[model samples]
Target chain A: MSLDLFLNQVVPVRQKLFRFAYRLLGNEEDAQDITQDALMKVWSQQEKMPELQNMEAWCMRITRNLALDKIKSRKYRLADELDRAGEVPAAQHNPHAMAEKNDVMGKVRQMIHELPEKYRTLIQLRDMDGYSYQEIADILELDMNDVKVNLHRARKAVREKLQNIQVYGL
Target chain B: MDYNQIIAILDRYWEGETSLEEEALLRRFFSEPHPDMPEPLQEAVPLFGYFQEEIANEAALPDMPEIPVVATSSARVVRLSPFRHWMKYAAVLLMAIGMGYAMKQYQQREVKASLAEIQQQKLEAETRMAYLETKKALELLAKNLNKGTTQMQKLSYFNDATGIITGTN
Candidate 1:
């Protein structure tokens, strides 16, 4: 693909890529940096762009790999806790219902964070990013059946955990 | 989006049978509240609501820096190859030390050349002194020889006087 084609076609989906990266990394700065870096990679590799089948999926895969690399490179990352997550203000809603909603969302975030990498990634792609099974498989380099099975198991696990949080208020 | 239909979709959703569109429908159904919405389904509102809000908050993409494309230039690379960053410093150091060593060696040679000139002058002075002393000694010997010849001439004069007395007189 030409550089102009890459700039117009691949770079425009940066918002979706950033959202996916933010969901995986749980921090805005890392997400933004990874998204930009992924787009820059596409620009750098424009000569090989025509060989790619799906440009959006390719960019997402690059974002995923870069985010995972960032996660790996952090030497002292805490488990289930992002360094900057506490600073982000909760969503503005009715002050009374906002507290309860924020609490539930916090619980859900924790449950998602606790999942194994494969399952959590599948859930993020399917439920949040709304990628089809084939697209998820393409991005993740997994079999289509494996994607479905993992997504089902992941959804079941999260639902069970959310139900526990409601019943026991834990 | 009635309560029973939502419930059935939720069942199908848990069974992993929902298409992307069907899942979107379910997410939309739970994201807002219905008066007839059961409380059991109310618990699921946060999960789907979080996903909707998560994606809906359209974060503006951060500005990307432009990368300039440069054509291949061979001369630029060849000119820059010998002076790597660290090696440049090392080359300067070596040049400085080499200049210092050369300076010291030149200074030593200068000293040696001056010393040789001084020794040659001293030798010439000594030879001049010896030649002057020998000239003085030879002049003294010549004067002594002239004095001895004069004394012999006086002795020969006395013999000539005796010969003249014994002649025609």
Candidate 2:
């Protein structure tokens, strides 16, 4: 019975968990390990499975905790944003316009990375992953209002930076 | 959507009030190029572009390998090798050999120590016997010397008496 539940619910969310882990750990390999570990942990704690209302959020929470613990234990350094900055896909046909777009995208990536970890995560979960505020709150273990306020502040910060980049090209 | 509608949604988005559908609309709107894009909407282009790129990248990621699950009661039990704990067995064997060798060395030392003690006792006994025999031989010589001294004294006295009688004649 438990196996059926796991296969039906938990296994399907593995990709989401992996992506969340990857964003947190900033690497694919560690993210994959954390996802696997989180799955094993969820399996071991099968007794709590029936009680959980949001199994996907619970799995993501487990993945985040595991990833954070790994970061703390190893003092893991996130992958350099500058290194990945060059990976932006070309969006323009002209060489000059493509380079310019790439540069702007790189700046945007850097701007996101420069946000505080909480703000950065909030932005990514809301904007990139399209997680609802309640799901994000469950995953991060925060209140709904707290998620809203922090997300607003995160967006405000990004917007101000974006304004700065526009006005001063800084 | 009209430019005014997008600007309104974008403004709501900046206020952190936009719903998921509105945000998706904004993302879709930014994914394409607008030759005459409004000034207010241009700031969001790169941000949404980055998000779209990231989503694409995640979608492009290789699927995770299938995790083995024992979903059925008839799942086969994996047989583990006996040598899986070889180090543990090897450590026990090493400890046993060390203890055995140590015991053998201790027994040999004990035997050697006892033999030395016995040899020392035998030497002590032989020296005591030699000392007693030498003392007995010296006592016998002293007794014979005493008897000869007593006979010489008696002979001297008889000679003195004969000298006195001859003076009287």
Candidate 3:
């Protein structure tokens, strides 16, 4: 395919790619930086990329690699400081109608953040980005069965955490 | 309440048995407001809601910076000729072998030159030692001949004196 056509197709998926990076890295600046870096890589190899079957998945794979590199380089602590800081105010408020939604959302984010990096990454791609199992497997370089298994386990873990929260009144 | 069916599906899900359609069905089922649902499945409602919300949020991510365009050439798509690839590899291999052979030849020449130099020095030292020994032997022979000549002259003087005394008597 021509360069213009490739860019036209890939540029629109940039946002979703950035979002995946953001979730993986947990920082907006790093996400943006990784997204740009991935785009540059794809641009450099545009000649070899058009032959690829799933361009979006390929681009996302690049983005995921870049984000993981950033995480490994800077050693981001997985304490979910962003979620915790945002949660403090909601935690202080009572279970008011509007606050309850925020609390639930906060708890969900915390649960996701608490998941292992492997499971969290697959979950972000499969559930958040809406990628198919095959696409997730390709992007993550895992077996299709592994993707399905991890996605299931990740969702189940979240479900279990929510159940425990309700039972223990957290 | 059909909580047993939901539980069974959840168990199957963790085992990686659920299809994409089945997963979507679970997501939808959990999303509904079922007041009569079991306590565990009830708690799962908020979690599923969070998943959907997060997905929507990801889809709504802001635009990223535009990537710079690169020039594309159609000629690049043509597969490299097999013969050309083979030639390239052969050239690389030949160059590597040639370099190794050149290095070996250089080392051998260095060793040969050094050996020749050592042999030449040993020959020159042997010639100088032979010349010094010959000069010492010639000096010893000359000293011995001078001593013999002196002894013969003294004996002739003695003989002449004895003959004169016998004639007078």
Quote the positional error of residue A101 for candidate 1 in Å: 1.9
What is residue B40's positional error in candidate 3, in angstroms?
4.7
Taken over the whole model, the C-alpha lDDT of each candidate is: 0.79, 0.89, 0.76
- The parts of candidate 3 lying over 4 Å away from their true place are A2-5, A77-95, B1-11, B66-169
iRMS for all predictions?
2.5, 0.9, 2.4
Q: Roughly what TM-score does model 1 have, to 2 decimal places? A: 0.63
> Per-residue lDDT for B132-168 in model 2, tens only?
9999999999999999989988998888888888878
Question: Candidate 3 overall Cα lDDT vs. reference?
Answer: 0.76
What would the per-residue lDDT of candidate 3 be over residues A1-170, giving only the tens digit for each residue?
55565667789888887888888876677789888898888888888775888888889889988888877888875436555464343344456765777777777777777889888887666555557888888888889888877787877787678777787856
DockQ for candidate 1, C-alpha atoms: 0.28
lDDT digits (tens) for residues A1-170 of candidate 2 = 67878999999999988998988888888899999999999999999999889999999899999999999999998888665765655465788978887778778878988899889999989998889999999999999999999988999999999988888876
Summarize candidate 3's per-residue lDDT along B80-138 as a digit string, tens digits. 67787797889999999999999999999999999999999999999999999999999
Query: Residue A37 CA error for candidate 2 (Å)?
Result: 0.7
Which of the CAPRI classes, incorrect, acceptable, medium or high, describes model 2? medium
Task: Highest TM-score: give the candidate number.
Answer: 2
- In the range A8-72, model 1's lDDT, one tens digit per residue, is 77767777788778767766677888888988787888887888788888888899999888888
